[model samples]
Target: MSDDLPTISFDEALPITAHVDQLRQALHDHQVLVVAGETGSGKTTQLPKICLLAGREHIGHTQPRRIAARSLAARIAEELGEPLGQTVGFQVRFARKHSEATRVTVMTDGILLAQIAHDRQLRRYDTLIIDEAHERSLNIDFLLGYLKQLLPRRPDLKVIITSATIDTARFAEHFDDAPVVEVSGRGYPVELWYRPVTDGDHLDAICTAITELGTRDGDILVFCSGEREIRDATDAIRAMDLRFTEVLPLYARLSAAEQHRVFTSHTGRRIVLATNVAETSLTVPGIRYVIDPGFARISRYSARTKVQRLPIEPISQASANQRAGRCGRLGPGICVRLYSEEDFTSRPEFTQPEILRTNLASVILQMADAGLGSISDFPFVEPPDTGQVTDGVRLLNELGAIHDGGRRDAVRLTQIGRRLARLPVDPRLGRMLLESDRLGCLRQVLPIVAGIAIPDVRERPAEHEAAADALHRRFWAPLGDDAEASADGSDIAALLRLWDYLRDQRRQLSGNGFRRRCRAEYLNFLRVREWQDLHSQLKQACTELGMHRNDAPADLAAIHTAVLAGLLSHIGLRDP
Candidate 1:
């Protein structure tokens, strides 16, 4: 590490930094401490430093998001006067960074939990920090329970749970009344304005307010429910005559570089239209104002429907506060709520945990494999509904992961169930991959799995969906005299063909030539690159699992056979 650390620009000491002694002493006194701090409190980045200063050399930190983990690792590395991958590193799915000298490790909660399967003691680290505990996902819940069990054995190991103000009580109680330490966040005043949602278009309100805000000093951030809202709002804003602004869309489906555009310190006015992802974990710099549409897609699993129901509903007051705080991170700002104050008051105090709303099939499998015993006995901070638990077990039994353990309702993993849990992909996709070898189609299924696992490469604009679809067909259309591809004429065949085409040209031509081919085909080049990375990881996983590898493509039926075999339970017919 060099003496010249990254330059510090903020003159105002963050709330966390002001209480270093109290935080450090609290960590020393308690085995588990809950740190409740709001956004801009500097707990996420500064806590690692406090851990280091407190002599916990090896710090294991888990974040709820990959982007947040990577970005935060970079920030901390810079602050520590060390290059990334040296002192600070992050590990996420299919991507990782670190060295033997790495002291502080940041990773997604999933990766951290995955570590438990191999390292029961977690001897590599002395302290473990779970950030973003407020948004209680399944991985976080399972990890918390597992860690609670492991702590007694590793008596020297320390644990710290950091969360926003919403769920401090639950976390503290979950750890058997772990001491809670609260830090007040940045105190800049944010002026709140209200406009109730009307029967008219919401994009109009977003556009008009943003255009008006663009005329003033700093950037404007607009929060939407989904990608459709993002696109419509972007188009409406671009259609306006704002000469000094750059309108960008931030969503989960966007490429990492495209998402980085929202964080880039541009010289001109920037308007970021994003989903609830921007509500927490990420801080967009130079945001002087925030516009909230007050609605977001909330997932509700239906046992009867056997699928997730993603309905657009009003955001809770906690989310609204989170959105407004984005503008006040660096300075005083304004928050424009596109809903009435009465409606805001009617919303829930906190958004329900995702573990409750989502299907628990995957979580149950991991828990069963992790020796958590059973879903009903799992120590979740907030237990999911009994219906969700029953549905999860039903699906697992259907997949043959669990069979009757001889008792009335007891279940155990079959041989295939153990293998399914070993695979990193979802159970359905894992089944397809395993069966592909039997059908002589491992090669074909690999690319299709990659496609499902990554973002969609075909970018469809709302205004140009038809044109985009036609352009995509150019690549999907069958090649001449190819019997394997034309066997079923399925869309899966086209996706495989596209992957083959990209790989073929890369072998025959230069990098630029392959990129040109992708552009002419209306493909997202970055997504193609991501797919290649995922494909490589899949191949590695298969090889490690002692599966035979096929170096050549298989016939179309072989691929479709495997895909349809896995999706048999999901197939349903609906009336037109």
Candidate 2:
């Protein structure tokens, strides 16, 4: 077995060596452990294989994002001299290319949760590695809490929690004093400069800083709160006096090709304006300068309104540190913070865990699906407010996703709920997709659902907003809300038209006109691809439900209501 093992070289720094040994020993000793390391540390890529070698069995690693899972798997495979999906495989919500013989499988945390729902024991893997635990995503937190209860029952299961910069003491306490191992990162010294900001100068200040940095060597990474800011900053940067810099805007919305450009190196200076997506999961290879706007868009659950709001808030110190560390990955760098040092000192140490922030409907559904009884009793590093838990159960009950009653007080998923969970979309959109299928509007409803789930795909030229609006209206069926639009009026046609226009313009434009179109329309080409994948998945769900394609008018009202079912908390009633 040792002879068959592939040999690979890594930086032999003290921290890397120590962390590798700790991970190796953890698998050797206890069946569960948590490894805490900052971003730019090699743990994300390196630790799993160390366990694979030490234990002589396949290792399963979970990531928060599909792109990160696939990219990291490919990089690890390359280092191990194995072809993609051979020794290393990856599985996301809609895509999977793994084999029984695969030594390591890297997948999204949601996928892992789905697997656990199917197989409570996770008997297939000898070791389970949960990466990016600090993100504290709904799935990650649930997995951690669930697995803690699972460890004693399945002593054979070895679990590893890998995080960037999290409060490990809390995690250790949650795991009942699971030994905590720390690893030093490879980040270089980054000069920090806090620039004072006026009330509305967020975009201007970031652009100005990027323009100043563009004159120097290396690429620039500007962090913003969301897609809107990313687009605004990208446009502002291009409009600035940095004619020499090639501006590339990156976010979850960009098409895979566009997002990939941020990672690609260019001859001239490249400026990447992105959202929080870049902070931890992704490592842009050549970024040497970082512009942090000090704000990030966080999805919050409003108990008062019982709604989910994507409000911009000051980033936690951990996130700020992660953003700054991006600059120092390759070499010495500079991080120009948009806020004063006073703001930094006052920031929260880490982000509020996802349990506290997000509408917990899906989380409750997931917990119910996982047979984790009553989320209130589940062990969390930081238990959510009872009001939030009550809201989650109530929301799930209203959506008809869970049956709520009994002496056990257990929540169980309905048949529709199971279908909803499998749709690779928000529970609300999943309900809409299922209902649309039943209504024979899969073709029409699927694309719209995809569009709503993916907001960064509507591309338009800065000057051609009128044209983009025209195209959008072309797909906007004038028929009543209850009427189904023709296939030509569907969102698929709109996306195809936009994609065709982008391809044509890419061939014709010399300046940043193509990017300007993307920015103006709030589109990310990569997000369109993600939407397409989502559309395909919904279609598969339709087929699984035995719904056939037909020309019949879909129950548009029912589909809308189904979407509203899961999104009831997010709904805004208009004055009648």
Candidate 3:
């Protein structure tokens, strides 16, 4: 007879070897465990195995980003020697994998947060592992707060907070002094050296350093602030005659296929010019050196503008440390800072949590719908700015989430607001969705609203930019290049028309055939599938809200009216 439980066959040894037993015992004894370790200290990969061995048959592990969650799940599933969607699975927005017999599941934090609204007890699993908690993303903060409240009610559940070793005290303190199991003495030593330039010519300084370091034996990683810097740096490196060196870029806006190049194993020296996405979310292979300019684009809520602003600022001490750790992943490495050590030390110790730096309108709506009182009194790990919270409420009111009762104290989700909160969209888009039904244009506007929320599905390869633009222009017949279909000349009609064409094309073929069709047309097949899924979900949500009724097909005028009705506040005038 064969044993049913899966096991990991080791080729060599992993870093978690020395610490697995302690982690197992800790999980067995405590309801909450904070696992702290450096990058490649094996916390992300090893903790799940320890939990399984400690007898957690079902686990829900959360990651900060969708790609990280999917990749981690695949890695773990392979190690377990099971089919990808059988014993282990992953769920992100518009994608899900799992079976009734699955033992472990990996999902993005947003997926878990949405689950909390339906399953407050989180009855799906006995264990919950929230990875990368130190990043303090908005979803991470909300999940931490949600679990903190749900723990007492369901005392049997296990919660583990994991991050690269930076600060665990705050996380521990937040959970009634949860015991922390530290995994140390694993990561390779990385030497840190600082180089500063008073001249603002970063492009010249970076190229010069890389040219000098070309004689080095290992690959390099350069951290930049944004896309423009990445482009400039990449162009500068390619212009050099450094033999057998390849430069690649990584940022959020890149296509999935384009981003995969950064992780590809190279025969020659590889230098990755990247944004902060490479800082902690991913581990690019063979990076033996790091070049940090000590800056990142950080989002901060501006009370004056009543919106979140992305400004390039100096990296925090913790972020700088994380960037340095990227080099020492495989062996002893070197990290060169483009900023002075004194300047690095002067930055903040850790980044402010997302709760304090983001627009809170969505969370505010969720809290009100969940019966958590005024945003002023919600239990946040880090309190948001009061003025910003006030601004969020005012915005929600504008979207009709709050009653227009003229009384300050009387605030709650209206009937329309309840329906708005049901779908996973911003209140403004939600308003547009709900208003479409009344405007007699729900069917016509549904795909357009969903398409607006995602990145474009069309791929424009740089080598063939003009050709790609021409290919995209093929779909611009009805909307034209000017894309005017109504009085305001909104591009939404174009989006809807594109979605309509794709929908008809999809219905004419099988899954593989449709994918082949998209490739032939130079479109991102995956994103098109995601758009279809979003449309289905929104349609079902509307049906649940009792807003789905067979009405006359709406014309372009009504569709424009619906969009404008929801966006009246955003219209602005410029002086002539």
Candidate 4:
């Protein structure tokens, strides 16, 4: 918005800037524009600025990640010769620094959906840009459907959907054939090597290949599907101690500080082990080699069991291409794929839309809060499973967030339900936190509830089986009356003694004991922080409700009942 800002160069040797300009013009003329560009194109970074400079109005861009939103905002602001959050700002969960003068705001798609819940029409901005539509996340898909219904009504609003490998024709047909603009990305020669795994090797073969490759000068990026594989691969590489390699793990579970380490430059040759999160939304600097495991962890929802399972599956061809493009960012590079060429030929061209696989409860709650009625009538690029939709409605009804008996023709939230939705937590955890007040065990119950909902707090050392078991024992609550016995007399004392032993062992012997305590367990630090935060919030809520914050613990039955209020759905029985 400021003319005094430094002139940014659009004079890149790439010919895509013309397409960017064309897309910008189309955005100006029509209320919606769909732009398709290949991987490595400057579209994600450059196009928003084009819109900002051309429109002289506020613009909002949504990314699928907090890291991507923040980093991309900083990069674009740097190019404009302005500090981040001055002209370009970003918002993620628990962090925001946007001002009235800010012309462009970038945020995760979830944040945008949260915003829409409060302000249904998103009246704050004149233009909205949805980046990475090809990801087909439930939130992104819902936003697309909502915006399609919104465009004709809000004539002044301009929308742009950007994706690298999206089927433009399909998207165009979805949007009633919105103007489609294709942009060619900067091309680089990349050599692809496909190696099929035999019976002897699993993912460990990747580390062996890296070691055999021997002292590559540039950064190495390895793509796996989940945090477990990333951590396992990183540990294996560290065990090998390949000279001059700075091993770093990248995944969503890491704290913001830890995630930032992967983006910063390193002195020695770097090896970044990451999930599919790094495949599309992020751009890591100085990568020259890519190791593709060809598998990603996908969250699948089961309507019959009403459970969500995270499993590893082969990635789509589009995802593989994006992984390959990581190597070519600087110049010509090599992609070492761990699957056979024939396997690659048989893989699906594009990943399935997340709307089809994930739990639709949250999306349904959001739509109900926004007065979107049942999600079935909402126009989606790919509609979710009918059973999943029914399951979502049933869950909402069970939670009292919606009152649609068996049919989901109409829905409304209760007062208690509205408060639960306001909390930035899963509905179950939110319900648990709220119930802590009525049960009068706000202190102890809130922390455990939050802990369960947050990431795990235990950290296990690699292959330390004994240590992992010890950590689990330290944290695990005893079953039935045994839990009560532990809470009573010498059980607490015995637990304290175990903690002391762990503390002492951690102090000495390089915390191998502590690592051993967590080896088999999936402990995460963020979950611990969330627990702490939940405790603080529950205390605050208690004070607001006229309950004493420092009251003594209530009856254990009440505490368990409060926990059951939220965790009823999570309850399971074991067979004898």
TM-score of each: 0.72, 0.74, 0.70, 0.74
RMSD of each: 8.4, 7.7, 10.2, 6.9
> Taking the tens digit of each residue's C-alpha lDDT, what string does model 3 give over 312-373?
66889999999998998778988888888889888899888767665677667766665544
Query: lDDT-based ranking, best first?
Result: 1, 3, 2, 4
Q: What overall lDDT, based on C-alpha atoms, would model 4 receive against the true structure?
A: 0.71
Model 4: per-residue Cα lDDT over 1-576, one tens digit each: 467445756747545677656766787787778888776577788887788767547788999988788778887888888888787889987688777668889999988887876777888878999998888887788789988888887888888888875687777888888988888666678889887777323456797669655776788999875555566577778888777778889876577778888878679899998877778888787889999878875656545545443445688888898899889867889899888999998999988887676667766766676566567788888876777677677777777676647365566777666666565445665566677676676665655554454334555657775766564564344333344346443322333333344345446743233344433344432232233444455556545545443378566567667667865776789799
Q: Candidate 1: TM-score?
A: 0.72
**Which residue window of length 10 is worst by lDDT in model 1?**
2-11
Using TM-score as the yardstick, the better of models 1 and 2 is 2
Q: List the residue pairs that clash in candidate 4.
A: 455-527, 456-524, 467-516, 467-517, 468-516, 468-518, 468-519, 471-517
Better of 1 and 4 by TM-score: 4
Candidate models: Cα lDDT each? 0.77, 0.71, 0.76, 0.71
Q: Which candidate has the highest TM-score of all?
A: 4
- The 10-residue segment of model 2 with minimum total lDDT is 478-487
Per-residue lDDT of model 2, residues 1-576, tens digit only? 456567755666525665666567766887667787777777887886787668547688998887688778877888788887877889886677777668889999888787876788888887889988889888888888888878888877788888765677777778778887778666689999899787445766886676566477888888876665566567677777576678887665456566666656578778887777788887777789999988875656555544444445789998998899889877899999998999899988888888777667666766777676777788877777776567666766666787755212577888887666554445666666666666666666666665565444655768777877655554345322322434445444454444445556657963346555655555554354445555665567677666665677555565465455556667787799
Per-residue error (Å), model 3, residue 561: 12
Cα deviation of 62, candidate 4, in Å? 0.8
As a TM-score, model 3 comes out at 0.70
Q: Enumerate clash totals for all models, in the order shown.
A: 0, 12, 0, 8
